[model samples]
Structure formats: C-alpha cells, structure tokens
Target: MYPEPMSKSLEGKLVVAISSRALFDFEEENKVFEDSDDRAYMDLQLSRLDVPAKPGVAYPLVKKLLAFNTETDNRVAVVILSRNDPVSGLRVFRSAQEANLQLERGVFTRGRNPYPYLTSLGANLFLSAKEEDVRAALNAGFAAARVYPDSAVAADRHPDEIRIAFDGDAVLFSDEAERIYAARGLEAFQAHEIERAAIPLPPGPFKPLLEALKPLQAQPAGAPMRVRTALVTARSAPAHERAIRTLMAWNIQVDEAMFLGGLEKADFLREFEPDFFFDDQTGYCDTAARVGPTGHVVSGVKNEVGGPRPSDR
Candidate 1:
C-alpha cells in the first residue's frame, strides 16, 4: 500500500529540519515546604536538586545536526527545542542566542525555540523519539510530535531533485549484524555474513521506506532522485556481500556504495554532497555532519547520556 520509491535525481535536495529539547530555562517556583517529602517529588520533576545539571539531556542527534550548519553548504537545518527548559538541559536557549549572534558573522543555523515552529519550519520534518520519551513528553504536558513528510510529501518537496544517502547496516538494514559485531566480535559477525551471503539477506529496517520511495524513483532522472541511491558503511568487500545482495534482491538500485574498512568517511561524503545522510552510528554521524545534513535516527536504547556514548562507557 505504500507509494513507490522516489526517482534517482530527486534524492537529497530539500530543506532539512531537526529537533532539540531545551529552548529556555524554567523559572523555579518558590516552595513553602510542609515537609521534606514535598521537595522530593518536586525535585524529580523540575530537577531543581542539581544546580549544574541540565533540564533535559540535549539529544546528541540535535547537536550532530547543528554541527552540519557549520560545514555543509547545502540544505538548511532548523533545530526545535522544548519551551520548558531543564537545568541540566543542553543550554538550548543559550545556544540559540549565541547561534543568532554568530549569524551576523555568516553563521546560518536555525533555532526553533518556541516548539510551535516545528510544524512549519519550511521542512515540516520532526525527529523520531523513543516511545518512552514521547510518552513522558506528553505525560509531562509537552507536545507529542513526529517527523512529517511522508514519502509523498518528501517527493513533492523535491519533485525535480533529490540526493539520498543511506548508511548500510542499521539505518538501512536491521541492527542484527551490528548487534552481533558489538556482542560477539568482528570475526564471528563476518563469519555469519559469509555463511548466509547466498541465502539472500532479509529486507533492511528501512526497506519499506525504500519501497515507498519507488514511485519517486520511477520518474525520469531529470524529474526526481537525480542520483541513484548510495550506501556508505564500515563493512569491507567480503563482509559486504549481503548488503549488496539484499538491495539487489529487493530490486533496489543503489548508485554507489563505499565500504570504508575503517577509513574516515567524511572525505568521500564531501564529494557526494548528499542533502541528507542517515546513519545509526555516532562515529559516522559526527564526521558526516561536517560534510552534509545528517540525521541520526534514535534507536529505542536509552544509553543516552548525551553526546556520543563513549565506546568504553
């Protein structure tokens, strides 16, 4: 029932919008303590217990996108934050104000401090949030939002030009192998992929998304999806067969694939100039952000301490 994939030419050209959770600091209410218990609940909610701690953990994904505004010359990004700021929050208001000041110096970052702008930030895209985060935001009286631009709208936005880039494993495929590499070791993961390379790999996590883009893909190259899809991943040749096969079996045509084999990907990305780049790994996102508009789709895992999770931590 989904729409077809977008055309090759209309891949990554469009306004890209991202989100943040802190826009301004909340004014702490004075409390007449009837008992110590009253302070306990208040502290948990308002987080007034820690002066240095922020109101909300600034989602590293947001920072990654913000970093894009600094480097990549293509695609505009608008960052949205919650109006109810958290003390431990990522200083969303300060960042916005500062980014505003830098704007005169030619810094072109966009800040959506007053949450309402999210729906109309020229891109109309919201980010993916964990179920718990979405619920908590709503439960705590914050607005529940989701990324807009279903395939049709995305196609319409760039009907004549789009350049999409996908990060191999997690962003395009399931994280199963990625989990294996993390849990068991590269040797074991590589062995598993070699064993099943001929069996035909399952559709990726975003396969449906690719299928939905088929319609857009069908149009003439000059009309949409100007470039065929590109897959960028850390997997090398022998370990990358399944990824290629899976796309082939799905009848998905990828214009390019770069197996980094531990090399830094930013250099290659700069040449590609993708309007939007998606990757599940923070390492790739960090570097790619310097080259283009990047989106780090949040997995359900709450290892979210803010910034890239330390590999050792």
Candidate 2:
C-alpha cells in the first residue's frame, strides 16, 4: 500500500482570502470580460501573461499583512480565492509575483461562488469585489467585506504599519442601538444607550476579525511590522460610553476611537490615513473611500430596504 500523503497546514496563522479583483487592478481586463464572454477574457489574459497588473485597493493592506511573516515565523498567509478561470489565474499569480508578494495558495472557481472554500482555508477575513460572495461569507459566520474598486489606494506614509479603521455599529458591535435610532430619534437612542451603558453590546460580524488582530497588534515594540486599529463611529458622548465599555468587556483595545456624532467621516479618515476602513452604511463608506481604501460591510438595519438612511446614523 502507498503511504498517505501529508497535507500542509495553515494552523497558528492569520489567513486572509482575497479575490483577484480585490488584490490587483483588473478593472480594464474585467471590463473586457463584462463586455464579451469567458473565451475573450481568457484569451486577453493569456496574451497579457507577461504583463504585471497594477495594484488594487486592497494591495497595500495585503502587502503589509504579509510582512508579518518571517523565515522563522509564518504569522500571516494570503491566498487568492478568485472567481476567474484557471487560464486567467496565471496572470493573477504573475502580477502578485511581479509585485513581490509571496502568495502560494489559490482557488479559482471559474465564475462560480468561491466563498464556500473560506471555511476550508480557515480564513480570518475575506475581501472581494462581489457583494454576493461577501454576503455568503458573512452569512457563513466569516468576516467579509466588498471592496470598492474605484476607492483611492492607501497612502504610502506609513510603510511598516498596517493601519485599519472600523465603524462601531454593525461592524464591531451589534446594530441593536442603530435599530432604536432608526425607529425613534437621536434623543431616544442616546437615552437607550445610557440606560444600557453597563451592558456590553453583542458581538458584530467583524468582531472576530478584530479579535484575531490582537495578536498581531501585540507584536513587540520596534518589530519590523506593526498594526494599529481605530473605532470610528457616529455615536457621540453618552452613546459612546457603551461602545467603549463594550470593547473593555471584550478585552480588546483599539488604538484610537472617534465619536463623530454624525459628522462627515472622510476628513477624519484622511487625517488618519488608514490602509482600509470598513463601515456598514454605504454612505459613510462612499465618503471614506475618497480618503483611503474602504469596504462596505453590508450588514445591519441601515443596509435594509426602507431602513434608516445614512443620515440617520
């Protein structure tokens, strides 16, 4: 009998699964695919096999995350979980190589839903340009977001740090308070949060993603690569207490917290210059994207039809 083959493991590593479109600037090529059929797309990609595609919105984040891995410790793993065919995948891998990314694993589903494989890869987060795949991953209890293809790329100011920002409701914590705000008004919402300030809000979809980042944040000072996180929210003053208390209750610490109380978040995000920012409401995401890379977390009441509009937050 032949001996059993040994399977490689991604255990004890933070695994990120990203779509090819999210990792590289395939907009032009994707336009061709959208206008034509699969054969045309494959032929175009094969023809440009020697060409290295430009970096996409998520490239800076992925590049910094991969820097955590070292010869002695492989702390992070980035895998291409794409919907392109095998033929086009060659260009994707070539792009990553030319960009100096040490990506080694990928799953190309040929225009099919690829989120199902996230569980097999033990993905801590999934970023894609397709909303359907992101929703599927979120429904399956994985942290996922849909990247805006036209969003601005991250600034090169912080070369060695991976800076990320997230909204409070529906992103890091449950949207229970947001529901009350939607049905009632700001006064009622503040009253409700003040009443329950002692109670920690329930975990949100991206809570696990934040928790997973704690270890990376804990890397020793002067480490080659570091992580910084922020909580940027519309809740201010009285309502803010609950959000802070919630993080304390969960034993997670964010480097910065902005309680804008419904102010425009773009200016603040521009100053912070995050590699990526995630918010449940597309309105906030739209503005933030103007400053830096942004993702729409399509969760909570704000995203529902006829629910509270972005202004309500």
What is the model-wide C-alpha lDDT for candidate 2?
0.92
Q: What tens-digit string does per-residue lDDT give for candidate 1 at 1-313?
A: 9999874321342322323322112223212222444344345434433233222222322332333333434222444433223432333334555444111111112322333443343332334322343333323323232321111111123333456678776557766676667666788889989988876665444455466446445655443134346888888868889888888888888778998876777788777666556665656666776665555544412123453342410
lDDT of 2 by residue, 122-164 (tens): 9999999999998889889998999998999854769989999
TM-score, every prediction? 0.50, 0.96
Off by over 4 Å in 2: 1-4, 305-312
Please give the TM-score that candidate 2 achieves against the real structure: 0.96
Candidate 1 regions with alpha-carbon error over 4 angstroms: 1-160, 222-227, 300-313
Clash totals in order: 41, 0
> lDDT scores for all predictions?
0.47, 0.92
Relative to the true structure, candidate 1 has a C-alpha RMSD (angstroms) of 13.6
User: Residue 46 in model 2: shift from native, Å?
Assistant: 1.1
Q: In angstroms, how far off is 209's CA in candidate 2?
A: 0.6
